[model samples]
Target chain A: MGLDQPLEGALAPPMRNGELAFEEPWQGRVFGMAKALCDAGCFEWAEFQAQLVETIREWERTPEGEYASAPAEQETYYNHFLAALERLLEAKQLVAGGAVEARSEAFAARPHGHDH
Target chain B: MSELKPQAIRAEALESLLIEQNHLTAEAVDEVIIRYNERVGPMNGARVVAKAWADPDYKACLLEDGTKAIEEFEFEGGEIDKLVVVENTATVHNVVVCTLCSCYPWGLLGLPPRWYKDPAYRSRIVREPRAVLAEFGVVLDDDVEVKVWDSSAEVRYMVLPMRPDAAAAMDERAVLELITRDAMIGVAR
Candidate 1:
């Protein structure tokens, strides 16, 4: 399948000269990571899209007013992206279940930039 | 070492697993990070804006064909399927958002600001752009028409911010410095 077909209606209609926008460094990181994973054959693009569709559906079920009341830090779409990715990786056994959660805790405890 | 957020940690772990499974290499992971940081950014867009400001022909070309004009800079990524450059004029202002999902021009403007992808922004910007702009401390005159562009995965939009008066005396490099990602996104002037 082509890249455009699966993405159709998955997002809003394209505006002229529009590009992918990232709000934070991690947003781009997550995007790049997902692309890298897809390139590596961990899962097909369609599989990830399925997970994403599921994630977005769950998010949409929340009452409209709930978003206004939610904390400022909780509004990242990439967070959902990560959640969906985690689900896929676990289902595929590409990474052991809970491995990411544990790694998250470890990094949070030490909190050091791992660049390079 | 700087502090690593939980998201960063998760990403690191994922990369490691990919490497361990022979799916990717450490070098490849590093290259991705570097690409996001250096290869793509607002600076690239700023240069295009600066060039447009300096040359009317270039501006016409940019407004006519954003994708081809941007390629003149020799940016490596081929992610943008189509690009549309909107001009912010005296009577018209343009702001962009993706209500369904966060689709933006990563190749030109780099990652969007946190607020750009916020649910509040996605839902509110289209309905009341002037009010949204005000909240961002950009209170335009009432006479100006605000055009809200909805971006998708196929086509991305960038605002060609009006060149500031100060830019008239400055070189292209100087003018480039004055262009912020938010300005290009039409959240700020």
Candidate 2:
């Protein structure tokens, strides 16, 4: 949402700092999904403080972006973030508190997640 | 402070010393980073497509809301304010081109791959989806209507190619093997 931040390279320093501190490297809308899901109550990522770090490390290993750093803990957390969410979804059976249900209706509430 | 500037000068001198010893090239260094981003950029989104195809509910959510659809994955650093995932279904097909400027979905997608960033590809794709795709070796049925999305302003799109029947039993990772970045932009079949 904010265009004020500088683009990567010859500009800003590395965005992730081994989990000590970091910036949101995503385009504005990528965040909207989590926000929308959060608003709907699919699950809040309050515990996601460390989750992002893991995800970053995962990105480093695959045929993805090869950062100068060995592998960031921040990325590793991020790499694991989805698994964490899925775990929560399975254990909680909750989507945005009950918002997951509404999101299920995102196009049309699946009355029960079944074909209409 | 003047003292601070002196300290900064010393730091630069020290950095230069390290650079000389390590055989580092600053200008070339940036080029390499950009090159890497180009190679792996759209592959991330390619994986997303595989996931959606394997799961029905995820596909519905993606069509309903692409931005949210991405959060369902582990990919990070997405620079998205808005996202529109276009599905290339049978009756209708979608091709993504950044006509005004290369506005890409960098989150689920790592970065804009090289060809998409090409001037020739950009200028021509919007004016001619069918023709351009043909160049990239992707031929579509003339009966299938092609919709070219000139991604500019407040919107960005990535194509969720209709899963090829050949990959029905494949897992998500296996399916990703079949999707090339060009397919995401509607250049390849």
Candidate 3:
């Protein structure tokens, strides 16, 4: 029932005082969602872990470094987490295809300042 | 094709979908955010620092075993591997960074500020601690030694910032209010 077992050793993210370190609020949100989903048995923990590993690997292979040099370029560890989560949810049929994209478009259409 | 968006947008989208599908509830998402924002954060670290400043015995325990000492406050997280507390003194100052990545003591300090995770900080802090501290407006004395702790997955560090003279008269809660996150990170004194 503990939240720490699946993310031990090589798979563990940088931590301080036993909590996961996140630079942005969304990073923690995404992280919490993934953990919550796993706890609810929507998918296996290993499944998400595999996807995350693939995402990180793909990022490492990109022409640029794993992170974008500029803020506008949009590369980050949590971005990959979102991408991987999307893939997992879609593949699991937990979410209908295009649901995430459609929701994202709706959010973008709003007038609020969107700084991620 | 869906455009790759920022993490916040994507997370929002994901949450909506999950809720719509009954995989998650809207309340769950709000609960997580509230937990991080309110229940856990720098205030926890500030309280710890305040207690250390007030009680020499607790400070001794904190310096000896940070992980165990922190548990006394009932702040426990599963992801933290090790907690090392570096004391800042008149002769030596300590700052922490994660060169390889943005490793931080989130259980005590909450989420890291944006600048702490910047590549410039990751690269520059190690090379020129004094100069970087200067940019943050922390000008150290010429005789003081600057020590930088690079946090890794195996171990994480928090700086025990030197107590200010004025703080001696303040109560624990007041002292806690004065301890900012930057000071605990050693970016500010």
Per-residue lDDT over B50-167 for candidate 1, one digit per residue giving the tens place of the 0 to 100 score: 9998889999999999999988788754457789999999999999897766677877886566566677788889888889899999999989999999987668899999988899
Task: Give the distance in Å from residue B68's predicted Cα in candidate 1 to where it truly belongs.
Answer: 1.9
A best-first ranking of the candidates according to their TM-score comes to 1, 3, 2
How does residue B70 of candidate 3 score in lDDT? 87
Docking class of 1: incorrect
Interface RMSD of every predicted model, in angstroms: 8.6, 23.6, 8.5
What is residue B17's positional error in candidate 2, in angstroms? 17
- What is the Å distance of residue A108 in model 2 from its true position? 63
Q: Report the C-alpha lDDT of model 2 over A1-116, residue by residue, as the tens digit.
A: 12111122232322221221212222211222233344444455443322443443454466743543322233333224433443354345432243332332332311322322
Number of the top candidate by DockQ?
Answer: 3
Q: What shift in Å separates residue B186 of candidate 1 from its native position after superposition?
A: 0.5
CA lDDT, every model vs. true structure = 0.72, 0.53, 0.74
Give the TM-score of each candidate.
0.74, 0.50, 0.71
Q: Name the 10 consecutive residues with the lowest summed lDDT in model 2 chain B.
A: B1-10
Off by over 4 Å in 3: A1-31, A35-61, A70-78, A84-116, B1-9, B20-23, B76-78
Which stretches of candidate 1 lie above 4 Å from their native place? Answer: A1-29, A38-54, A63-71, A74-76, A87-116, B1-13
